[model samples]
Target: MAALILDPLAALGRATLAACRTIGDVTLFALEAVSHLVRPPFYGRLFWRAFVEIAWFSLPVVALTAVFTGMVLALQSYTGFARFNAQSTIASVVVISLTRELGPVLAALMVAGRIGASFAAEIGTMRVTDQIDALTTLSTNPMKYLVAPRLLAAVIALPLLVLVADVLGVMGGWLIGTYKLGFVSAAYLKSTFDYLEADDVISGLVKAAVFGFVIALMGTWCGYRSKGGAQGVGGATTTAVVTSSILILALDYVLTEAFFAQ
Candidate 1:
């Protein structure tokens, strides 16, 4: 009986210890990446390539998601507010909802799904195929050459994506309001602008930056640490996406609380 009880306890302790070690390792890795960012060898071409991959290529999906979200949000807001005779508030609601919450969160989740998995697959494959070792042999720092560019691109791209998302979302609401709901185009746009504070937008952008960092960090860490071979690479890719997505949602709540704390 005592042996059984102690065995489970021991297993739990080991799992807990492993989790702590992983957290420590990830923290150190992130610090190292940041330190490398300030050092020489900026890798401009890689940075530009990553920028295009992350930002420009991501536009179509982001635009579609944002516009449709805005339209649906406008309809929902009108439905709820109509009961209270507050239909005019729909524009403000849609804009604020997009800027303050939906825009950054959804965009980050989408990017994490796209880029996070890609990073893991690419890097994990490198680890398996010995390409990373080759880089070190050639006097190239893999962290700078491979990781830094992607990290910087994600940080830069996510905020821009969120900004575009904000605009498209608001435009979606405007289109729906004017065409479907009989709202005056001029009045809806005016209300959206009037009630949407700079702080709301700024806070979302700030969240976007943090989310971008976390997404890249998770993806790189998973891929770099992958073991085995093809199976390991697949597992790393899936883990990267799942972990990045969960962190994005969890961090969104923490950021919202921080931004709105009374």
Candidate 2:
């Protein structure tokens, strides 16, 4: 009995240590990449490429997700508030929910699944195929060349995507409210504008920036450390998406507490 208890304790201890080590490694990697951002020999071409890939290529999916989410949220809000005869509040709730929580969180999650996996696969493939070695041998810092540009791009791109998401999401709510819910368009728009504060939008944007950084950091770190072969790259891609998504959710709560806790 004692042996069994001790064994489980040991296993838990080992897992804890492994998790701590991973956190430290990722922190160091992120610091190195951020340092590259301030250092010279910037790779503007690579940065632009990453920006387009992350921002432009990602727009359609994010927009669709946002719009549908908004429409659904409005419908759900109407259903709930109708019981209390508070249907007039649906527009304000939609705006606040989208700008404060749904827009940023949903957009980041989508990007995490897309850009995070792509980053990990691309870099992990390069790592396994010796392409990363070639860059280092050629005196090109792989971190700067491979990681920094993508990191900067994600940090910048996600906020733009979230901003667009917020707009589209609100529009979706408006469409549903006016067409299906028998709401007056002018009144709904007025309610949306009136209840929306700059702080709500700003808080969401700040959350987007942080989520973006986390997404890129996890992607690059997993890719940079990937080993083995094709299997390893595939594993890294999955890990990047999973870790970024988890971090986005955890950080979202922390950020919400910081912004709104009284």
All models: lDDT? 0.93, 0.96
Q: After superposition, which runs of candidate 2 have C-alpha atoms over 4 Å from their true positions?
A: none
Residue-pair clashes per candidate, as listed? 0, 0
Among all candidates shown, the one with the greatest lDDT? 2
Which numbered prediction scores highest in TM-score against the true structure?
A: 2
Q: Per-residue lDDT of 107-205 in model 1, one digit per residue for the tens?
A: 999889888998899999999999999999999999998888888889999999999999999999999999999999999999999999999999999
Q: Which stretches of candidate 1 lie over 4 Å from their true place?
A: none
For model 2, which pairs clash? Answer: none
- Residue 29 Cα positional deviation in candidate 1, in Å, after optimal superposition: 0.7
lDDT (tens digit, per residue) of candidate 2 on 1-262: 8998999999999999999999999989999999999998999999999999999999999999999999999999999999999999999999999999999999999999999999999999999999999999999999999999999999999989999999999999999999999999999999999999999999999999999999999998999999999999999999999999999999999999999999
Worst 10-residue lDDT window, candidate 1: 53-62
